[model samples]
Target: MTTETEAISDDALADVAYLSRSRNRITILEALRSGPHPSGRLEERTQASRSTLERILTELEERGWAERSPDGYVTTPVGERVIGEFRPVVTAMGSIRTLGEAVAWLPDEELSIGLHHFDDATVRRTTPNSPMAEATYLLELMREASVFRTLTYIAPPLSLLQSMRDSVVEGRMTATNVLTDDLVGYLRERPEQTPYWREYVEAGARIYCYRGHIPCNVFVVDETVLIANNDPDSGHPCEFIETTDETVRSWGRELIETYRRNSERLTPETFTEESRMSAEHTS
Candidate 1:
């Protein structure tokens, strides 16, 4: 006898493809969802030609997905179930099409987390009319959040950093900024900003640096997880995807931990010394 898993996989793949390939067919099924509709109505609702509608209806009938009676055609129970199951697939595909590289450019581990976690995410893409949309939104979140964390190669805006620093210094917020060692070294060369960074550490901000290539920027503020991407060539914001889903939040928390665990914790005194040395070396 054929194994159950082997038996279902072949049939299931065919069935899923059957329903997903043709928008006309899906439209016909959806149009018939509310009770029944005559052929003329189906053609109008599905925007399918008379011949095409007839052909799809025949296929649907053969598949037990629909039946015709005096009241035109009505969806079978199985058809209803199939459509319900298939709608999420459509939605997820739509999301993928819309997000494009914003999702694809994420690290390999992020893709392994699967696409379902992103189903509920909100994407803020940069537009010609609003080039700083993503950055502006992230800055707003930073100012409002009671907890802030990031794993990024990109340094945040100084104004936003100052806000977070003040909150942490005042004991009103908890914050961490995890960066690659290369980024930290570069920051040390900026004499004006170096002292401010050291002050950030002294004021209870958690800063960690490690050797690695950071591919994307992740910021978890309060209960939200925000992932951002920028164009590699122009350094312009590409998109920012934000979500408050518990699963994504859990993944974000674990991701921060992984980056931090591999990093060297920088104290205020050590950071100050490192900056001084870096400045000397640069001069």
Candidate 2:
């Protein structure tokens, strides 16, 4: 059989474990640790009912940390000792003295942010303000590349249309368009506006029309980093990113791969039927 002292120690440890599970219980215990009060006073102070306070006090009494009296309750010798030990542990856990020191411990590489811009034949501006110009320059580079691949998320906007026309007219590069359903509809009805789209369909340019919001707009060329922006500035007016950074380039490539894996392809035959129906509707 366990001795009275050993049994009391086991019960004390169990009480601590039980109280630790509830922050409310911990708060009540911490409040009562200073001293004890009447059931009504403790209830008011802790915002618990009298019955709940009595139950908790009963538990504390069973653990030999508190005693009931004619007046109400009081901390026992064991209770004072337990609270004294707990104070230092709680103090150590709560201290935020080294918050700055903890922040300083992070690696230097992860804390760096900068920009590098490249033009067709040379390095352009390498400042923070160069993203817009850099995006336009990168688009021009894709227009000039011999074997360019494009996977646009939305319809070809006017700027993109002009770029495609220039690319075809200059015999620079051919492009594959992976468009959203809305963009496909826009293209189908504006047949006269996008002769390049018709020409591309005729000349074996792969087109895909899908339904859903294409969460991002991305453009990549010849596996070299070009433009990657998640939140481009107002002058840029597009929530897209353009970058030559290795990290950004990998993200762009993964996006393209994911789109290819998920999207359905629309062939010339599909385009012709859709275009004719759109033309008849408009006419």
Candidate 3:
């Protein structure tokens, strides 16, 4: 059975190819993105002549890519869904490829594997019983090691949060988080856990306050190992590797470095906003 993530990926690919086809197609789609539009308006917006635009619209309609109404044209349900799926894929592809190319430009021979998931065991040991099982085992190992050092990353799942918290409580680990504003807000509502919250804050864990979408969740431990999902937009499986691996480690390090550099570019004002918000609730 195709997992939800895989199905979404396929749909997203279809959407990307359709949208990336021609300027006119994109223009028309954008014009009608919000709602139905008259053919005349679409042509004007897309800068296509009436006759030419009509032909294109007719073709799209025939293919069920869009629908016509008295107002103008509207993306069909399928078309809308495709557009929704494709937009993120396009954005993520551009971001990831650009970062990858930049890494390649460096003298390092790093190989970034954009796979759905990584088996932790592959890095810890050579043997494996099942790929899935091995991956789980590897994650546990990483968690155990994470206790002694400071681990940092963007928004991770609740399970990860609990595991990190456990390590910190046991004096095995401390962590910093650069969470989106939304996530910060999410953790703020619960005041009962104020003590735990204080521990994170006092330990120097800070939220990343910004109002934008992050394509994927990244995990880098001690700048030595990096793990990230293949498609940033989709919550597919994730891959992990040691930073020491000539090829794999280099790519992972490059991505972390890129994120760090770009993250620094974030205005201090935004970071402060996040810190303030987190402090208010947790303190």
Best by TM-score: 1
Q: Tell me which of candidates 1 and 2 scores higher on lDDT.
A: 1
How well is each residue in 234-254 modelled by candidate 3, as lDDT tens digits?
A: 332334333333444455445
Which segments of model 1 are wrong by more than 4 Å? 1-12, 18-91, 278-283
Runs of candidate 3 with Cα error greater than 4 angstroms are 1-139, 146-155, 169-171, 174-176, 189-198, 222-226, 230-254, 257-283
Overall local distance difference test of candidate 1: 0.79
Segments in model 2 whose C-alpha atoms lie over 4 Å from true places:
1-139, 157-159, 165-174, 224-240, 269-283
Which prediction has more favorable lDDT, 1 or 3?
1
Task: Quote the positional error of residue 132 for candidate 1 in Å.
Answer: 3.5
Estimated TM-score for each candidate = 0.68, 0.42, 0.35
In what order do the candidates fall by TM-score, top score first?
1, 2, 3
Report how far off residue 274 is in candidate 2 (Å).
6.2
Clashes of each: 0, 8, 12
Give the alpha-carbon lDDT of every model: 0.79, 0.56, 0.51
Name the lDDT value of residue 122 in candidate 2. 22
